[model samples]
Target: MHTDPDFSSRGRRLLCGTLAASVLPASLAPAAASAAAGNWPQKPLRLIVGFPPGSSPDMLARAVAEPLGQALGQPVIVDNKVGAAGSIGVASVARATDGYTIGLTGNGPLTTAKALTPSTPYDVARDLRPISLVATSPFVLAGSMAMPAADLRGFLEFAKAQGDKLSYGSIGPGSGSHLAMELLKTHTGIRAVHVPFPGFPQVATALMGKQIDLSFMIPSIAVPQAKNGRLRLYGVSTAAAFPGSGDVPPIQSALDRQRFDVASWNAVFGPASLPAPVAERLSQEIARILQTSEVKQRLLEQGWLAAGSAPGVLAHKIAEDTAMWGGVIRLTGARAE
Candidate 1:
């Protein structure tokens, strides 16, 4: 439930995980041309996930693989290649020349990694092409229950009052949680000490234990704590009230004059040379998949809102978010360790 679902790749054993592909439809022809007479996906397609099994990206990859394969008239196999904050797996996808291999990952490797680690092997804009966005969820600004702040405004006043003593936690430097908090600080003209933790679990523990003052956390992880009265949710980082989030207003509602929006998004991407026909058809198929009631319900139950967009739309998102986070990284003076 961390901002980057692929964060599981950090400090973990490397296991090449795989999801067994579903059997192709009996009516479907074995020829790749069955789908649309394309010279692609001549055999089983490889869908590479940068994170290990059960991570957010892996889950997304698994959920979409069967349908995407069926639509493309091939078996979509998920191959987990985990390491280096998901950069290793992404780099592999970038180097893959065949259209048969694609990547399903989140912000960590795609958007945030470049600003944090400029020396990363592959450049996102130059190497990979955007296919479509799968789903998204806003991060909640949460406070410990022990704190006196009752809402976003009160928390802001409290943070302003504390000044140098106010402290917050994030998964690590340059993560979405870290950068989002920094962006909030810049917008609101407030400052707080930052305490970097290894992951969301630790950050939640520290907050519940009253070791930290506040943090930006994903709704799935923060909701349970709030439900049990261990955490007090203040604001969600979005333009409007997020669905399934308990009556929490957008962060802009607190600031009045300012607006802020950030979310963890899972998307599909392939090497830059992926043919337009393939990318366009894949986007259309994914959009259809997302519209299905079953898939929508499953993603919502997991604290995600299913969203699909054209390839150019996703490309715009990637560019915009990359620039936005790059500014935050510079403002916070955060760099990869």
Candidate 2:
């Protein structure tokens, strides 16, 4: 009976050892294969845009998607998840479980949205990882050519004179247009009612129709209208005149010793905890893509300057812009429509 019990104990121990050996190797097999292959982005990649179709960010994302798809040897899809000042798309990207998901972000959701809406679901710093900054452009302070404000100084004086009666249009609350206008209002102490539009085209149309008195717009979209006498270029929202539009002077130059600056930018971001190797690879490919002559010409033609910044550089920029816009929002008491 003692021999039988001892033999049974040995058999149980052997079975347990065999199970551990089988399970351990199986559990680590995927990790080992991943390490050996370095096969990041093994699946199709999704680039999420916070705006609807035909928007600036959406356009850029589409432009880059095909080339990036070729670079990664995987199909890249642009997913437009528009809403809540782009927070909806951004939050979707943040919550995505796949490593192949990235967000095409702009000033709205990335920097100014949180400041305008404190209840933002994802932390820009904690939930998203910066991939690269694609481009930058200065905002153009434009108005109806019919208005008396020919320049920035005259515009401010006109705004002050109009006082509570003055109204301006923005794409939406927490948009770059809104923040730029709010910053101008805060700096100049001019009070104007904010009229929110669904998108830039609507805002531009409203300006053309004289539905809105004044608004800040991007040079690519607004300058042509100004040239066609549909709208007048009052000033640019940069310290110096933008490179492409020599006729439009800087807002600071027109305002006596008062400084105002506002610009728009686009960047790529991936979900938090994206593998470092994957991020680095994507950054390198983006930098290369931006360096292409065709890409440069296209961006310049659109009134944008190619940024081509690395991942770390873009991370720093996001941090800096977030803090800067937070103060602007607080000071202006800006809010959503």
Candidate 3:
């Protein structure tokens, strides 16, 4: 993807304008801001999502959009730009200097995309500003009923026995699910063919249909199916038991090996040069929203933990995950397909 020259110039101006505003008096600062502090959101806001509608990221975006809009005194619209493992939508938000165009994205495009494909258009640390860490969930390593693996240890043995004959499904290359599975393979020395799908629903469908033998599925999909006997769950990828998954222990308990804790997270971000007042107001508002009983209950029921973190927390997470997933990609030799 090529960088737009106009966007570069606008980004520079945005950065300079914000710097200039820092020295101005409170009464004069609003005039220098692109989206003035008093009336930052004079129009409807656009929350650009990278994944298709109904996916985890999309659902999370929709969950917060209305409430966030109410807080800002504006309507929030969700725009789906799906492609290149979610880089397209992320890049769109990166180039936007206005505060009205924000992004709701996960670790895939924000951390792993550039490492998997160096030609990726935007840099998370440079082009995007962290607003807050929204929510988080863990993945469950599930096996098909046909696999005959009653436990995590049994599943490992089954996988080793089948060797190259075993296959697993993932949402796509460079996704959290994909890297989590690869990390499992690295620890156990088990090998399997990878089948990439578009999203978790399709991966769940393929697992139930026996199109694939195993996969790392989110708890929302894995829990209900496991209860109904549609899928066999071996263990959870998180170090602790996932909320709403009853009686299921961490994977380490089943195999007596070290646990692998990898979580999938969704966060809010705006253009890197977004004004400090706008960023602070948005983050503080989101944190308050996530604390309400209604929002917390809704998220918990859907297998998500509402994590309304400070902007610095999200920035640190992005940097840490970028280095972590970079190693995983290098180990598995996964490239953008």
Candidate 4:
């Protein structure tokens, strides 16, 4: 899953000129001259989304693209390269020679995919530059109302009783839903089979068709179905109840103690070699856009919490989650087919 060990070495070399300028004397620095002449984003930029159109990542990508394009003064096109649990598109962005190419990634491909697919081509730490985190959506355990589970406790009991017969669907093999379910199974000692779909719609459809026992779905997709009596929500994956979903109880209340809280987050990322100035500019502009009342309202309507953090904070988050998921993956022994 890790890329060449020398990747960081080459990245360090590429950044050496910029790194030296800060320490060298003004009169003697060729680095400073080169940095001064470097104008980033002189052409159209491609924002690659690993998920298909209408997915959470795709929606957020479209939401931020206009403002990002305005700030960079270049077109920010969102290209959908959906496949391989998002590794297909992500690897494409990683291999692109153009600096303008970036990826709109989520928790799946950025962190969990590594553990799932050992031969994955891209390395998040070495290949991608972290930009601001756009938004976060918590997961919810949802089931068809025809089932006996009424809450998290009831769901666990029912799952235990069903044993190998019960099953759950997730976005893909290494998705947040799959990890959360794995953790739940480990904690509860339930033995539901893992069923993975290509995307959310298919999972939702399977639930509606009574083809699957349950699923961990995003609020935007699950909430509407729950309201229409198509799906019955058991509990949220978060430790506490979310803002809009008052009717749905938090999983913590049903279980004696909660062990997992997973959130599906979307963030903007570019090539690691992108200039610091350009990264800062993009971060600032995104922060401004998220701060606006209109944008905030739109995001709220979609069950997303606006998170406009600095580039450094975003990078730190990616690193922290990578380590966190590594432990979970090791514990569950989860892998892609």
TM-scores of the candidates are 0.88, 0.82, 0.84, 0.80
* Candidate 2 vs 3: which has more TM-score: 3
Error of 1 at 317 (Å): 0.5
Clashing pairs in 1: none
Residue 323's lDDT within candidate 4 is 61
How displaced is residue 56 in candidate 2, in Å? 1.3
Show the lowest summed lDDT stretch of 10 residues, model 4: 13-22
lDDT values, one for every candidate = 0.79, 0.75, 0.80, 0.75
Candidate 1, superposed: residue stretches over 4 Å from native: 1-39
lDDT of 2 by residue, 112-174 (tens): 676677798986665666778898899898786557877767787887888788778888767
Would you list the clashing residue pairs of candidate 3?
none
Cα RMSD of all models vs. native, in order, equals: 8.9, 14.5, 6.3, 5.6
- lDDT by residue (1-337, candidate 3, tens digit) is 1123444443344334434434544553443385745767788989999989987789888888999999989999999999876799999987776557888987788778877899999867567777888898888888888998788787888787887898999988777788888888877877988999988889999999999998998999999999999999888887878767777767767546665778889998886656767777889988988888988888888889888877767777776666667778887778877
Query: Sorted by lDDT, highest first, which candidate order results?
Result: 3, 1, 2, 4
Residue 70 in candidate 2 has what lDDT? Answer: 94
| Rank by TM-score (best first) | 1, 3, 2, 4
Error of 3 at 97 (Å): 1.7
